[model samples]
Target: MNNEEAARARVVSTADRLFYAQGVQAVGMDAVRSASGVSLKRIYALYPSKDDLVLAVLRHRTEQWNTGLAKAVAAAGTPRDKMLAVFDFLAEWFREDDFRGCAFINFFGELGGGNSKVAAAVREQKTSFQRHVAGLVRDAGGPGHLAPQLALLAEGAQTTAAITRDPGTAAQARAAAETLIRCAFE
Candidate 1:
């Protein structure tokens, strides 16, 4: 990578870990500079401001999160299995040593009330997720309309797992989704 590109990537990567681990509001630019080993002058030149850096991090995370989910779902054998694979993805994610739940959810909780840009990014991530779930439901012979309910269960699983630090919540959510999908077809 070019020098500027390398610096920007370092800043964003460092910020992603710090912001997700602590919180966006809790992490500061100096901390990002220190953690990334990027000079403060370059950090500012790349991101322009903390908000800019935050927006970049959120956007980067959204892409990565969506890609991971899609890959997991695709690896399943059947439509129904694909639908259930979302919880499998969650299970693995929650088991990660540094699992911090949904970054968008955390970011929204931290700054959604005051920051329009952050709020927008959060909403976009959620909307995209729900849309993906809805498509999976439709493909799996469940009503697409039931996507919201399924999304609720998936999100609940993530929240509960994050709070309780228990990966088992994913199984519970998957079981609940199975019931919801079965009932939707009946």
Candidate 2:
């Protein structure tokens, strides 16, 4: 990559790690500069402002996170397996050393009310995820409406796992999904 591209990548990566580890409000641009080792001039030239940086970081994370989920779902053997794979994805994410729950959820909690752009981004991510689950449900011969319920289970599992520091919540969510699937389609 060119110098500018490389610098921008480093800044975004560093910002993502710092913001996720510490809340967006808690981590300042200076901290990002120090952590990223990118000069302050380059940071501002690239991001312009902390809000801009935060938005960029959120967008970057949204893509990476969703891409990972899509891969996990695609790898499953069947539609039902695909549906359950959502929880499997969550369990793996929760087990990550730096996992801080869903980045969209955490971002919303931090700045959604105050920032319309951030709120919209978070909403888009959630809507997209729900639709993904709904598609899997449809493929599995289940009612599409059950997608929201399944999404809720996955969200709850993530939140619970985050708060309780328990990756096993994914299993609980998978069990719940199994029950829901059985009752809905079987």
Candidate 3:
């Protein structure tokens, strides 16, 4: 990558890590510069503001979430299994050492009220996720309206897993999901 691109990537990665580990409000630009090894001047030139950097980090997190979920769904055999694969993805994610709830939810809690741009970004990301779940439910022979149920389960699982620090939370959600899917299919 070009120098600016590489620097920008480093800054975003550093910022994302810090923002996830600490709250976004807690991590300053100086910390990001120190962690990323990018100059403060360069970071400012690239991101313009902390809010801009946060937006980039949200985009990065969303892309990572989409890619991982897609991989899990693709590996599953049936549409129903594919629908269930979302929990499988969540299970793996919850098991990660640094798993810290949903990025959108965390970001929303941190800045959604004061920052209109961040709020909108969080909403759009969540809406996209719901749309994804809705498609999966429809494909799995569930009612179109049942999508929210599945999405809510997944969303709740993320929060519970983060709060409880338990990987099995995903499995519990999965079991609940199976019952819902079975009922929907019937």
Q: C-alpha displacement of 33 in model 2, angstroms?
A: 0.5
Model 2 C-alpha lDDT versus the unseen true structure:
0.90
The lDDT ranking, best first, is: 3, 1, 2
Q: Residue 149 in candidate 2 has what lDDT?
A: 95
Residues 22-131 of candidate 1 have per-residue lDDT tens digits of: 99888989999899999999899898989999999998899899999999998999998998899999988989999989999999999999999999999999999999
**Candidate 1 wrong stretches, greater than 4 Å:** none
Deviation (Å) of 22 in candidate 3: 0.5
The count of residue-pair clashes in candidate 1 stands at 0
Model 1, CA-based lDDT = 0.92
RMSD of each: 1.0, 1.0, 0.7
* TM-score versus the correct structure, for each prediction: 0.97, 0.97, 0.98
lDDT of 3 by residue, 1-186 (tens): 998889888999999999999999999999999999998999999999999999999999999999999999999999999989999999999999999999899999989999999999999988999999999987877898678999999999999999999999999999999998888878
Best by lDDT: 3
Task: For candidate 2, give the lDDT of residue 142.
Answer: 92
Using alpha carbons, what is the TM-score of model 3? 0.98
Report the candidate with higher lDDT, 1 versus 2: 1
Best model per TM-score: 3
lDDT of each: 0.92, 0.90, 0.93
